[model samples]
Target: MASDKSTASLTTASSKAILLLVVFLLTHTLSFSQTTTRTYLVRLRDKVSSPYSVSRPEQFLSQRSIQRRQKQNIAVLERDLPVNPAYVTQLQQAGAKVRFTSRWLNAVLIEATDATMTAVQRLPFVTGLEFNRALSRPVRSGGRLGAETDTKFGQVQTAINYGTSQTQITQLGVDNMHAAGFRGEGILIGVLDSGFMNADEVSFLKPLFDEKRILATYDFVKKETSVYEDDSHGTSCLAAIAATADGQLYGTAFKASFVLLRTEDADSEQQVEEANWLFGAEYADSAGVDVISSSLGYTTFDDPSQNYTYANMDGKTALCTRAAQIASETGMVVVVAAGNEGSNAWRYISAPSDAAGVLCIAAVNQTGQWASFSSIGPAADGRVKPDLAARGQGTIIGNPDGRIASGNGTSFATPLVAGLAAGFWQANSRLTAVQVVEALRRSGTQAGAPDAQLGYGIPNFARPLATEEPMAPFVVFPNPFSDGEPLTIDWQTINANASVDATLADLTGRTVWQYRYQPGKLGTLTVPSLNLSAGFYVMTIVSGDKRRVIKLLKR
Candidate 1:
């Protein structure tokens, strides 16, 4: 009886040991599987209980953003609200790590294991889940980690001159606009790019920080405030618009307010970056930016299967293109690079640039000829792409280290055009966003016959300000007059017997000077002395009921 009891005990101990071993193996295998992470796009059902409202846009949007929409008569809609916090919390609770959230697409980017993904999908709030890409080691181009280091600082020039940038600004007639006292004052521009390393440290951009003109900044890749710490691509692009060193380099809209956004992941090419761009655009819209300048483009990715074909260049196909169109519809002028694929196998314009209503900028040389590297296009939908052209080849840019360097790519041209647009908008604040785009297109040198290579050719800022009817009943010689100099006016009274009532007002319509003249004939009237600050102004001449308002530029 004792031997039989001992045998039973030994058998029970062996069984328990086997059970313990099996459990250990199973747990190890589960942990190994969980360690391999994959990225996915989590599509949420709705933002049902969002902590924002369209009626009270001030709660979510900046005062400038609300003002921009109001200026263009764009209404605040429910789509502008933030995503529901509850949905995000529920997602986090399911063991999935959420990276970025895009309210425009109503989606969230998450990283998780297969089991976690299954759990997330089973949740009621998750409408669908699409595999994005595997989260492996970043495949950086040239195997470099951070932004390319600046080696051109040693080649700095001593003179404070525009250097190679003269042709670019002068070619677009922006020089004339600058002389006319319109240098993007009161205009807000948003820059969306990969990174802006040393942007805050650059000498040319010092005024932006000092004046607090940099309204906002966000990094969609790391989901942090490290926009200025990333790649230098964005810094180069921003220099084309906001750099304000007197001679070394002057960006197109140097005086414009800026909202910098880092939307690209320079480490890898993926579809998530497109979502990042959409999020950036939505943020810019809510911040009340007037123009969005993006030098980033998409075509191929690190994953072969995720590569976009030429057909995807259609305005409505790419995710970024759709977002850009939505941005334009929301009353902000969208400017994008036409891509630098002219000599490559994929020689075509990229997304967002193909989107209609957005000003797609192509690259050109100083002589106004198409750059060999400039992307060619008639968008897949047959719309004329690259609505305008600007200097891109050998374009001058302010390096992050305070040196001026020349870069070649449509990337440089996009900001030049964006700054020009801002200056034009500043000159004519009464024009609607759509009207501003149309005026720009119409003012192009080749407006009558536009081609894919050069679009409407280079835009001339003076063309848009030229009207069919005379600006006023009188003409002012040397219209952009120096502050201490006398102004010569050639006037002709509309009513022979009526006296002439003349008033000079600033751009804000505040009367700065008033003069009443007796019944005047067709003759030149010289004002001996006039004191006015440098800016744009309006001179109104009233002859009885016939009043004429003419635009005036003060130096």
Candidate 2:
């Protein structure tokens, strides 16, 4: 009895130490100054529910209840088989490269390469070859439509302004629309998460529920109607862009409706957990939900056999991708986490998020540098990913309880953008999902071109500018010129015969002056010397295929 007591005491101490570690980490991360709210995860103690009297695992997690029924083996042979230190040896014996090995999953996802996929069928114990994919992301909204109306739920928590600078998440193209009064009034967001606590008590959410905003909720793990306890991760994610309080955590869309789908199984590590997510999305779709943003992605599994490798991050390898794809096609804008594997060996975004057409978001720091943990991409298909950026690193978060905290992860960044998109849709309710995405993409600060690291850079809150637009030209010394200096117009382009596409306009797009571009064969063209006015003016060089718009300034 003494030994057992000692063991239990030691376990308790260990748990406490872990809890302290969590607090320490969160305390040290950078948080945005903006008062916003979202829910988040904390290392929590397990409160055990007594085991079933009978072997009725079906009571809560049966195939029908949880939708995690065991699936038939379908992965190709190359991905099967264990890989250890002897991975090379195993590959050498098989006459294959060692690249197939996935150290994290302790298994290999080999490729046939020159070998036909049919070769995999002949291999012993080999299942069918399955393709992996990333999920699709949502399109951007144009702008805000109105102020959020007071609801029975009182002031709900929102964290929209939390991390646009960090993660560079810009898919929320029309986030300003939320401020304009489009709060996803008729839309529904399904949160397939671990648990919920104090969700019923938030004031802003009361009106939504009272007005039947909460369509439905289901607990896949417990198969219950209530999921309002224990988990704070989903709540935090939801708050990133959806929560709203007058002075507290403000969501991009303070009035968006939500449905909590407790599909994640925090206790277990298996393929079935992924299956649960599919079921949750399916349920949400059937309920006519408008948008789905899941801050979850899977590549590595505790069990070696079920793990995915870097190459498997083709956006289609996992079950999650299959469902995420379907959700998007159904017209529900889907935004998925880009994964936090920046430091991991197989550090690329995982499935569903890697799926084609999904706008993956990478986390960034305040200075616009890539967040160390933001998932890397150039998806296996060779497409640059993280369609855009948003604040993600060390973002402030709200929990299931009315408590506020800060966190860092693609998980948090995703919802911030999602909420913004919801707000956009609310602003232009007539906009289709694809239209929303295009507006957001075009509205990007770097929409003219995109690459892997920071897909489209950060977003501009105003109307999205285009590369082809025509404007005026000006020569301002010390570009981004300081105030009070004679805005110098020294240039070969400003030669007597040369003409500058000199036309200035205000924010409202009214042409202040128009100076036509004169054809010139010279290497450079300069407009006539002139003192330029400031307060944001566009100076354009209108040469065919050479359209450059430079900003000017004056004292």
Cα-lDDT of candidate 1 = 0.80
lDDT of 1 by residue, 1-555 (tens): 899999999999999999999999999988889777777778788878788778898987889888888887889876777778888888899998988777667788788888888899899988885434453334542111112333342223423355556778888888888877788988989999988999999898999999999988999888887688888888888998988766557888888999999888888877777777888999898888899999988887776676778888889888788889989988999999998888889899987799998999998888998998788988987888879999888777877777877788888899999999999888767667897898789778898899989888899776533433445556776776776678777766466667777788764457889887776554556655676665556677676666666666665
TM-score of model 2 vs. true structure: 0.56
Candidate 1, 478: how far from true, in Å?
5.0
Worst 10 residues of 1 by lDDT: 141-150
- Output the worst ten-in-a-row residue range by lDDT, candidate 2: 141-150
Error of 1 at 113 (Å): 1.9
Cα lDDT, model 2, residue 256: 74
Q: Which regions of candidate 2 deviate over 4 angstroms?
A: 1-175, 202-212, 467-470, 473-555
lDDT of each: 0.80, 0.55
Output the number of the lDDT-best candidate.
1
